[model samples]
Target: MTNSTWLKSADNRVKLLIFAFTILLLPFVALSFFTFPTTDDYCHTLTVNDMGYWAYQKHYWLTWSGRYIGTLISATQPLTYGSYFGYKVAPAILLLIYVHAFITFAKALSANKLPTWQTALLAFLMLFVFIAEMPSVAGYIYWYTGYYYTVADISTLYLLAYFFRHYPAITAQNIIVLSLGLILLIGMNEYTLVWLVILCGSLFFFKSIIDKKLHFKFLVLSLVALVFGVLSVTAPGNAARAESGLYPTPLKYNLLFSLKSSFTWEFHNLSKMAPALCVLTLVLIPIACILYTSRKPGEFGFFFVHPAFSLLVFAIALYLSYFPSYWSIAEPPNLRGQCVINFWTLIGWTFNVFVIIFWLLEKERIRPILSLGVLSWVVAFYFFSLYLSNFNYRSAWSDLLTGRAARYNKEMIARTELVLSTKEQQVTVPKLKNMPYTILNVTPDWDPAWASVEVNNGCAEWYFKKKFFYK
Candidate 1:
């Protein structure tokens, strides 16, 4: 690569990264976060006895460890969707975490071989791939419980990056911190717990096979974390919880049912969601090929083989993501679970299409046919984004603009006045349900139970606990 060629590649990556940052940031533009707790947000909060560290000692190690941070910080609900758009630590932390994951995956793919910008491009492509096919992208971001799980789940990517980036310069402190991070990530949720183990184990085994010399320290950490992760899943508390009629089906029957459900769900979802999937692939496939398909620049004629290899890895990843969902009956079969699984499925589907297109571009013998196929999809995406997808975005944005949001925000303040003034156990706060959300049911209402001093209201006192609110 000449100086000019390298510079051009670098420039293209920066442009693409900026584009992705814009896309990832786009949803916040429609600020309509509801004040009232919606669906599971109410239920999850009810499980937390109080906001003390003892809340961390409760059963369900996996769910507690996964949600501990978010549940703690989220003492107050969004109050309004607009709360998340600002520079506050609460709203932007997830974006920063995602950026870190982006950087990590980029390093894995390109390392020193590609420019920094290319890494950014890869990260954006992955996010775009997931967002385009997501069952409910808004739910993953705006739903408090949903976002908590998603954040912990995404920690897998950060951990992978930590291993890849820090393995070379591992200090004692680094090892400890990284190990702790791994523990949190592995115990985040069963879905992440199961697949993350496979990811680390596969990496460990693959390194042993390919590198001929493996790091004993890395292996030890991996194995220890793996054991602890599995233990967390099967903790005595979880077993007791299960026995208490949380899951109706027996263990053996649940396993078989899970596998069957996993397959049936994937195929059914893929068929239903094909149009959006096709649009994302059409736009992203060629771009990934053009930017840098093979990690090694000198690998000639491996185009067809490499895409297949990429496809296989993503396919396995997608398949394994569903394992935790099937293993137990605790997992929801709605958009929340689908959103998590769809993240990986969409990634696999994108690579499967990208590599095939990339291979055709390499073969002049069948260039026109492949080129036409790519062109057709690209055109399809163009129409889909402009006509179909934009309607969805606009509709979502418009829904939030209703007086209900401003009304709810005011009602919440007024209700707080009644409670704070009277110091009452219960107050009939003014009605404040959110406007309809298209992708997520952010259309929330207060659970009447939450009004109790023992229940949600105490947990919610954190919202007012802040100095900013009191001052």
Candidate 2:
């Protein structure tokens, strides 16, 4: 076959692979909207619903607390969930924002303008987040309450990339966008503040120290973000530490638990590709390569400094955030989750690798061995995402549905009526309250203004007033 024909055939296979990968990812992303909602989902929904009610009653700026957002949603009836009329629409809005951001990023990168191999590489990278099944079943995404922050940050990252492309030197518009991101980061999740700090600080240091282009705009913007980020934390919901001491063990025990969770590739029957370990491996690879080759310092200065410094700084910061000496996972109390921390680490690590690869490819230094290693990593990612995508803890709907008694209770909650049961027909409460979908546990005698229930030995027979949403 002609050389061009051979190249074209190879390109076709790569495209086909990309297509298959995209198709596989489409379902999980779509299904997430309908997948049995999580406990946090309900909590967030309650907050959303409450926000709408509050906003309608009072015209006030919506704080990070779902109070304002929920109140806003409640003003509009159509947005209500099936039974949980108060369920917030923030999740859906966030999902839509992510989609728009991704599309805008693709267009801005001119990803389609690249060569076939480059295009395929970009496509894979673009879908990398989904392939990883981020913040879904993963602890960092699921447990840490990072799902919202991650979604927002992903949008911010797209904006950053867009700014990077259009204006190499920061401009007013870039500053505004980035400042907004920093504000949003601080408002949404505290951990994201660290990420914003790293990005902005890196840009400052990289410009001043490495590139010697102390662009005033960049420096001023970073400083502004840092200042406002600090100020933003003053909000009631956004505090220094989460409610950490409440669940106090010694720092040592907490650290051990966090590290154990972080280090082990497996947790809760789900296997995660350990981002920290992967990073350690990638870091070792270049160090070994450098020692063996002993290439001049300047020859690979960008490769050595940019990624190693950036990733190491972030990883170390994250590790210290869960430190043995002073850190506690329980404090701030607003949201407690550390699950997707590693996913962010993995993202940082992946970018670290990308920078290295880009530098190597530019220098024509991607040797056959290096190329093979890269290809192997891609395959590993594919299988890893494929496996993680299917990992879910719950099975069977019957196990989750409210019993007949609970259904009857819900009907009363909706209609403000009472449930009647004769001596011959016992109308007892179901196990619905234990399920994740339930927002509030309403009893047969419970009032909307003041709700309370008592469960002895984990068994409660009170009739519920209404059906919960997202069941």
Candidate 3:
């Protein structure tokens, strides 16, 4: 190829990267625009309405099931939601992570020293894969409830890539950064930190296996991961026992069900074909390289396939972690099944993301059709996931929201100038009673048996109690 031709190809690759970045942001705007104000959103709105900016700080008082960071944000910031916005720091964090993932994927493609066309293909595929199977976007981005998971997962991936790229230069200073990253992951949710540990271990294992000289580093990584994993899983220092009225055990059990639930959801997506294509690319690429090098035996060896092999190793690690049905030993499923599946899922997702890149970066004649097909499948999968999410919300919405009559009270509070003098009122509507949420105690009556109360602003306040509020 001539110098000018090479220059044009490089320019095209750069343009393609820019295009991918633009595409990534479009979904964020699109999803945020259409979602209705669900109950959790409304409840958050009510909190803002009642406490004003202080509601943000009060979020810190609320313990996150997995991570403590949200509480930290709420603690530091007087959580503010006006007529137009609720606490959006979580979503903003997600945006940053997605952007970072795209950039990293693109740079890796560019650096792999592949042909120009191959580079463009790789970049496009990465973004495509991310949107397809990552139900995080559908669940959290749409409802704003699951955004933290997206933020934490993408952030952990980005951080892992950064650490890996600079492994030799990692310093004591980097340890602090890694610590903060762990805290943020845990804050996003405990599962995230657990996943982070698994991923670090996976990466270390990959290096040791692939490099032929990194056994010590791999051992060290495994130990660090083991220690971090233990600390993360056990660190819920102040968890309270569930009240008799709640079914916490069933919910914990549901985490086990995640093995089935996640795979079922994933397989249902049309875009899952992308992973199959990735496996094909991984297989074909080595075959092609073998043929290319067979023409000149001195130019290459089986090790020319190291990147592909590395990918396979990583892919296996991911499969074991995320693909729920892969763990056959656990009967009917156990916490062991869900114990740290997110790690594998996230890593598996990352591998898929890169496979999409490889598809795009291949210099074959069918590139355009492959790219379009992959992109179309991903978008279709995203919409399907959204449809399923809405279906779930619809199924539960009436029971969880409309049945409560809490929206009416929330709307009333929205219009009132009532200084929430005291968070001192909580009403427990009888379970299975089918009664509308009582507007009782707007006039300040406290019957301890009939209510639970805390003093927030000053005036006695009453609210219904539930396992989870609507969002």
Candidate 4:
């Protein structure tokens, strides 16, 4: 085929890939309609309603967690106003935001050489792998509390995109916007705070070295983010909560365990998902090559570091994310935390692979060997294997096709009705008969000894203004 014809064919194939990936994402979004509030949702609703928004924020800062933005979100959760529909639609909205941010970042990274639609196709592929490999779909995406982490995650992408689009000559407006964005990112959660500090610090260090001069803007941004991070970490609530026995591990043990478990979980998931990750890396190679070729000479100075240095930085950032959870909670990060880690893993790993490819391409001896036709077949085979092997997507489809999601929604509605209508202050509800994997089910069984039962019961009672229990 002629070069022009091949280029046109490649464009058409990318469009097709975009459509296919969109179709694959539909089940996850469709599952959102059946989502309901769970443990923390009820607790947050009751606390925020009782204390008022600002007071709730103060309460969390002084008594529970140092996540200032997180508390703000908790104070205004959709369920705070008894909007079940709002609750159900939140995950879908978050998913859309994530999609937009990823595409925007991709465009910026490629210096807008890639068409918007092609960037979107790239985003869809990454998001697909994220959903497929995430440790907890329901907790990380469906559950309101856990999914709030996505706000910071998405903001990070946008902030980086903004930086990439207007670096080294960032205007005053850009600085102000980026500073505010950094505060938002640092206050949402500790994991992202650490990641941001490291990211900005590393950029500041490397950019100075590459350009042979200081970059004051990055230094300013890093300082701003670090100040907020310090405020978050030093909040009285952190100490209070630590002593409250929620995290009973001693500091020594916590440190030791975190050191060991960080590497353990990282390697475990890396090994388990190697095949899928390899496929994703293969798909990203040509795209990365395109990005490398499109960049103006001497642009993105910090991005073209040696592969060994990039890998080391990636490993450090990844491990730091694990350390905060282990230190505070005396356990590995929960699935929600792992969700953030896994998302970053995919992103960072992809970038690291790109760095390697860029190094090879710069040498003029290496070129992408696979033809577009062959790559398309590989993409097709990937989705086929993904459909067959991805438990999260399979479970999502099962929940929808088997009517489990509908039944679960119906049952929750019935339970809510029972709570509202019963004249008696105390109400007993039946156990959930259909538990969909796509939705978080926080209803405790008959066993009161269950860890979350008391908290769930208390929140349910407060929210319903009645005594609530389940058989």
lDDT of 2 by residue, 1-471 (tens): 584465357677576656655553443333233322222333334444655655433432323332222223333332235443222233344445544564454444432333444434433444454434443332222221234445545655576556645553446877777776666554444455556666677667775777666767777767866775565445433222233333444543465565664434224212344542453344334433332253343333334445556666666545543332233442221212242354355445545564565455446676413223445566557555644543331211221233432443354353322222323233333233332222222234442212221222111122222332212
Give TM per candidate.
Answer: 0.67, 0.58, 0.52, 0.91
**Candidate 1 off by > 4 Å:** 1-20, 23-51, 59-89, 96-100, 112-122, 162-180, 206-222, 245-253, 272-279, 282-317, 330-334, 347-392, 402-404, 418-430, 436-471
RMSD of each: 7.5, 9.2, 10.9, 3.2
Model 4 regions lying over 4 Å from their true place: 1-11, 115-117, 250-253, 368-376, 441-456
Residue-level lDDT of model 1, residues 1-471, one tens digit each, is: 484465357676587568657755554433434334444443444444343334544533434333334444333434323233221244345655676776676565334445577567557656655555556645666556566457765776676556555554567777787778767765555555555566556556655655588956667667866886767766665555445554665642376676776667667777765666666565555454543444344432223344545565565665556655556553435576677667556545654664576666666423322123537546645644643455445544455555444455455556556656754444445444544454345423333313322234444444333111110
Top candidate (lDDT): 4
Clashes of each: 2, 32, 22, 0
Better of 1 and 3 by lDDT: 1
| TM-score winner between candidates 1 and 3 | 1
Estimate, for each residue in 370-433, the C-alpha lDDT of model 4 and write its tens digit: 3355676777587788877788888889998998988988888988888889999988887778
Off by over 4 Å in 3: 1-24, 30-38, 41-64, 73-83, 86-97, 108-121, 136-138, 168-176, 202-225, 236-471
For model 2, the run of ten residues with the poorest summed lDDT = 453-462
- Can you write out model 3's per-residue Cα lDDT over 1-471, one digit (the tens) per residue? 584465356676577556655654543542332223322334444455566655544443343232355433332221223332333234444555565674564444233345544544444444444444343333444334344555555676566655644454556666666656665665555445445566567656666666676755445555665665564344443232122222234434345565665455434442444553454344334333323433333222222323455466544444334432322222222222232333345345445444444443443423322233345446446544543454222322332345333443244344232323323343322212232211112213432112232322222122232221111
Clashing residue pairs in candidate 4 (N, C-alpha, C atoms within 3 angstroms): none
lDDT of each: 0.53, 0.42, 0.42, 0.77
Best-fitting candidate, scored by TM-score:
4
Query: How would the candidate models be sorted by lDDT, starting from the highest?
Result: 4, 1, 2, 3
